[model samples]
Target: MIALHALQYSRATRILWLLADLGQPCTRIDYDRTDAFRAPEELSKVHPLGKSPVIEDNGEMIAESATILRYLVAKFDDDSHTPPRGTVDYWRHEALFDYVEASFAEVALRAIMPAFRGKPVPDDAKAALDIHLNYIAHALGDGPLLFGDTVTLADIQISYIIALLERVGLLAEHPTVAAYWAVLQEQPGYISATRTAGPMVPTA
Candidate 1:
């Protein structure tokens, strides 16, 4: 069985969402953050970085949301969540999965976090966010998901980031992103994870 060290209002929500969508049963171990919004010391015992979304499976532990998602899809997903290996869509899946973190996720995190903490968002930071926002909107295009109606790992990763943008009031400017956010919000798995992750994350 997979065990998730889930942190409320953190990236772990998406990991839970992914698990729910994939129909995989997992033991979710919840953690509370310090008033300062830092992980508790118990988390550090799970991994060196002490981050949420760590998964323990088959006597091995994995950290990082992207890494865990990749591992799960490769090891546990069926054709519904991922295409067969060696096809174009499969490679696209690989690219988008990595791109979510390597590109937008990193930039977006630095952008709205100060605002999330009630600090003013800097002009340069907003500018950087705008660039990625445009890129994300274009990627989302007309469809609600990454590959039309298909819900792949790319959709899971990007949709969670889109949800973050919504929470922080960043989605209004990007209509395409806003539409995609609306679509993901209706998903059963997303709804389940949202409710489960609610108490741990910020209401803001």
Candidate 2:
């Protein structure tokens, strides 16, 4: 069994979704950012940052949401359905995944996050975010998924970020983003993770 350290409304949801996709049984310790449950000091035993989304498997600990997702996919490759790593689609997926992850981080910090938290974002930051959004929109190009037809790790990771942006109403006027978000929300693992997270709130 895997042990997952999770926090509500964090990237930890991505790890949970990946676990569900792999059909693995895991234990979760849910933490909240509120005063009552500060991140346990003991968590450094699991990760350097003492943060959520740390996973323990076979006496080994791993942190970082993207790393966890890749680990689960590689560890359970036989049983889990995943795209072939050697294929062209896989390369495309990887490219898009990196682009979106990097872009979203910038946009989140600059535009989406501030708006979601009811804080004001600078006009310059919003403009930068719009440029990134346009890039994502172009990359999408009417495809059901990021790379092509099949769902890849890229889809799972990027969709979660998109969902976060959606919660903040950042995609209100982006039809392509809305379409992508709709398809992702229909996935069982995505739905499970989202339900577990409860209502979305803006937090790091």
Candidate 3:
């Protein structure tokens, strides 16, 4: 069994969804953000970074959304959500999984920071977001998921950034991207996670 340390409105929700999708059981410890919208100091006791989605399994601790996702898939996925290893599609899966945080999520966070601060998004930030959105749209061309109609771990990895874009209204103009998120929200695992973790975006 995995012990999940989850935080509100954080990438932890995606971890929970992944576990639910895999039908894996976990002992979840939920955390709430402070009035400043930061993780409470209590979380530091669980991990040095105090970030959510940290997992304690078999006496080993794991953190970072992408790292945790990879660990979970490799351990519990039973190949249901990942392609067979060493195939072209498998490499694509690995690349897209890393790309979400390294590229798209970074740009999405830049664009979202201004909105979260109650300021207008800068032209450059919007432009950068548009470039990434176009890339993602092309990557997902005419498919419900990144690879095809079936959802994969890469889609789960990318969900946080998509939720952020939707929260800041960046997805309004990109119908394809917007629709992709809609489909993700309809997943049963997503529904189960949100019922406990709330929405991907924080109300505050």
Candidate 4:
């Protein structure tokens, strides 16, 4: 069985959604993230970084949200959560997942960091975020999903960031993102991942 060590309200939620999309059975172990957003010390036992969203499959440990998502897809997706390999859509899936984290999420996070610190988002940061969001909005072009008609991990990956933006009130300014977020909400595990996963308790 897959063992997922999730940090509440973190990217681990993305893994939960990914697992659901893949139709995989896994145990979701939620952890209390500190007010500082750090995972509890116990997570260090699973991965040296002590990060949230670590996973173990058959004794092999995996950390990092995107890595865990891709690993699950490689091992268990079986054409369920993603398109078949070697197709345009499949390659698009790979690029979008990586881009969602490496590019788009980076900007979304910059915006989120200020909110997390209880500070006003600076105009410059907002501008930078706008540039990135516009890029994604354009990349989405005419979309329900990033590629093809069906939902895929790519959508799930990007949608997680979009949800973050929504929570922070940034999503309303972007029409494409709003539309995509609407479509993404209907997918399985979306509510659980984005809203229903709930908050972490203090790990005392």
The TM-score leader among the candidates is 3
Candidate order (lDDT): 3, 1, 4, 2
Best lDDT goes to which candidate? 3
RMSD of each: 1.9, 3.0, 1.3, 3.4
What is candidate 1's lDDT per residue for 54-124, written digit by digit as tens? Answer: 99999999998888987887787456766668999788777877888888887888866887877877888
lDDT of each: 0.79, 0.72, 0.87, 0.75
- For model 4, residues 94-171, the per-residue Cα lDDT tens digits are 877788878887777888778656689888888989998888787677877676467777776776677777777787
lDDT of 3 by residue, 13-60 (tens): 889888988888899998888988899999999988887889999999
Candidate 3 vs candidate 4: the TM-score winner is 3
Better of 2 and 3 by TM-score: 3
Tens digit of per-residue lDDT, candidate 2, span 162-193: 87677777788788888888887777887777
Pull out the clashing pairs in model 4: none
Displacement of residue 28 (Cα, Å) in model 4 is 2.1
* RMSD in angstroms between candidate 2 and the native structure over all alpha carbons: 3.0
Alpha carbon lDDT at 13, candidate 2: 79
